[model samples]
Target chain A: MPHIDRRIGFMGSGQMAEALAKGLINRGVVTPNQICCTDPVQARKDLFRSFGASSYDTTLEVVHNADVLFVAVKPQYVGAVLTEARPHLTPRHVVVSIAAGITVDMLLDAAGPEAHVVRVMPNTPCLVGETAAAMCVGGKATPEDAELVSTLFSAVGRIYQLDEKLLAAVTGLSGSGPAFVFLMIEALADGGVRAGLPRDVAQALAAQTVLGSAKMVLETGKHPGALKDMVTSPGGTTIAGVHELEMGGVRAAFMSAVVAATNRANELSRMG
Target chain B: MPHIDRRIGFMGSGQMAEALAKGLINRGVVTPNQICCTDPVQARKDLFRSFGASSYDTTLEVVHNADVLFVAVKPQYVGAVLTEARPHLTPRHVVVSIAAGITVDMLLDAAGPEAHVVRVMPNTPCLVGETAAAMCVGGKATPEDAELVSTLFSAVGRIYQLDEKLLAAVTGLSGSGPAFVFLMIEALADGGVRAGLPRDVAQALAAQTVLGSAKMVLETGKHPGALKDMVTSPGGTTIAGVHELEMGGVRAAFMSAVVAATNRANELSRMG
Candidate 1:
């Protein structure tokens, strides 16, 4: 495979597509004009245009023009979109699918036997330049093809490469982890509001607290239990909270949530 | 009263005291030697020496030498430490207590009738450049006293002023919130490990995902739920994880945890 200047296209102009485009452009990985997207919906097309990226009405145009095509449609529609766009794809074109629960095998089948395919699971933070994504290659995708896809994801945030089999677990963890965290922050903030703090003050406190504590774990590299012990004294308030969480089965609940999502992803793969 | 350069003392030689001392010295708010601390433990004295600050053998020496004293002792010994140091305190000195669950009333009473006091609850992230701290002033503290204490905390991280009644809730939320988040990240990383990703790779993804998503919430000012919906389509994998959380009562459990901590803080205040 020869190294070529990166030309990327989005088969769908949804939030994920726009976020990746925004991240790539902001990081100087690709220019606004160099990236192209197509969406049947007028609002989505207009939204993409506002970011100064080129937008098309049909998937054929994007597949015909770009070197790397990101199939960003929903998981259920991935088959239809890939089948429709496959004839325009050649061996030189690297196809990456961002639809969750859709496996690399299904994507490769839809894009034809000769097409190089990479499967990616990226979370919501990519829109704001803080995405955690995992990418894996299958079929005709060479090392060069994998590197190209990795570069695109890395421009937005951290990227990891794993066997395609574990991408669903990544889907369960990072891909859906943000929502679980958001809910946690909301519940904490609501506690503050109920305790008589003003809404904005409460929200800021709740959010910044989460932000700061997370940075602690990254910077210190200490065990979470040690840090928890630092904050908690014998018979102190924090221990009270921990006791409640334990009693309420918070940890088991989160674990089960991730497992459930992973099982669902596997089911989707089998269905496809 | 004339404005004088205040000499501040930290009574414990630990991460929190060192972090605050460094922050104050970095900002020229106080000098290394101008701040005094005491830890009966030799290891803690060495840690203070590493920061180029003076460490004392007894709490009385620290209280006698400094105009503003931070009682950074652990929660269990706050009473004993304050009792030992109280006789040396003068009306000119201010006592700032960072021991969580130790009330301002208890601190003032322990330090005697003339001592001006304040209570603060801060999380461990203060070691970095970010911390969420909530503070409340004692009956004797003036606005100027409050401002000075606020300035000291600001050097370490953000500081918020609230009624003393709400301090326990702040303790429940941010002061303990980090541990809850750390558990979530650990569980998520464990899921990745179970799915065949390397431990280090899984840890990095889990940690970075948290960092980025938190940045999004802080920067965007959008409702977390709204941001969540933006990432999730009608039947996507994110919604699948969300469904499990809903099923397992994640929101309710976390909310109850905060309330439990608040109640415990209130109980601690009455423990004498």
Candidate 2:
């Protein structure tokens, strides 16, 4: 990964945008002084300014100044913001959208044919420096443009290069998946409380278990099934617990959650 | 956290013993020669030896030489091993047991009243330097003794101090819980795959989401429900997906898994 020193700007200053800006500056990818963002909401603009970043009231100022401009607004606002900044966007500028259900073609249409557009679907884990984010290249996006976008998001988490068609699936899985895991951790903690452990300790242990197991999967590069088997010693407690998860249909539920979310994303984009 | 320089020894040189030896040596708590272990299997002994730890074929040698002695044998073998090493065990030695269902009281009974006994239930993620481990002090153990054990395990992962009565809950939640998480992550990956993402990419994203979300829960110290709400906007993909998870009984299933595993741990200890 190249060390990015370019000025990064955002068209919105929501939590997602702040997560990226804070992550970039914290990792020394870019300093706060190198970050500038635009937001109509005074409080949102003030929020970004708290990180030592410059804030603007209009989108064109951000588009004109920054080398990489992030379109981080709501899905419904992407077209309007892109159109407002269309005249200022240059071929050298990379416009990346973090808004869900916003298509690369729609962004390209609003920003003009020469502008480089990259679409991203990032989960809230970006705030914790462990986000799972995916990016898609637009019609005019160069390989360098894709690299730059990946590098920016990579500062916060793992980045996957994706096709526009597959971005909805990414939205459904990693995008909405954090909430599911949070719920599971919460429920696991509840079980611990019921079993006689203190609330705080159980939550801590449950969260750590999820964090560690996820890391084991990435670090070992072994199959998850193999790792699960490693812990399940024949007729042991782990196997017994696994039987409950299986019988409770956890696997099917998670599968359906992603599918349902993906269909919802597809519908939103279609409506847009 | 005091830096532990005491000589550490393992009575059983299995994967658990190797993990501790390697972690202690890696963290510079004790040098390779300062660590010693006894095991019947040559391969297991060789594994610890690779980390500069001395290998012995008898349990008495490990109990005699080290200031902190770890009894890492199987549950059925813990009593016999402790009984054989009882005469060699002194007041200065802190005898720790990592075997499941082997209570601190049982260890105290085998090793006699003078030795300090501590019991731990740690998940397999200790191998990745991010384990969830809990320790309980026996009748003869002092606060300093607990501190030493906590510092030792803390080198590889997070440690929680609890009563011996709560160890079964720890076993079910964090001990056997890693397997439950691996299954959930695999199931989440399966969901991602069903939603049209590639198998490897889907698995990677799913694992990262779990890892990141877990970090969020620990770092933010906020309620998991609040964190879930932070990601879920009105009519957004996350909320839509969360609804599916709610409909699918994910929380109930995870709660049942932990409860079942805890019950199993209680039963196993009773049978022992």
Name the best candidate (by TM-score): 2
Can you tell me which runs of candidate 1 are displaced by over 4 Å?
Answer: A1-8, A25-67, A76-93, A190-203, B1-11, B21-69, B75-95, B109-117, B139-158, B189-217, B224-236
Q: After superposition, how far is residue A117 of candidate 2 from its true place, in Å?
A: 0.7
Model 1 agreement with the true structure over A1-272: per-residue lDDT tens digits: 22237788999888888888888888788778888889989998888888888888888999887889999987789999999988888888999998877777788789888889998888888987878899999888999999888888887887888888888888877887788778777877887776566777677777877778777777888765676777777787778778877877777777776776777777776876
Displacement of the residue B158 alpha carbon in candidate 1, Å? 4.2
Least well predicted 10-residue stretch by lDDT in candidate 2 chain A: A1-10
Docking class of 2: high
lDDT of 2 by residue, A28-122 (tens): 78889889998888998898888799998788888777989998888889889989888887777888888888788888888888888888888
Error of 1 at B123 (Å): 1.1
User: In order, how many clashes per candidate?
Assistant: 0, 0
Pairs with backbone N, CA or C atoms under 3 Å apart (clashes), candidate 1: none
How accurate locally, in lDDT, is each candidate? 0.80, 0.88
TM-score for each model: 0.79, 0.95
Which residues of candidate 2, in runs, are more than 4 Å off?
A: A41-52, B28-33
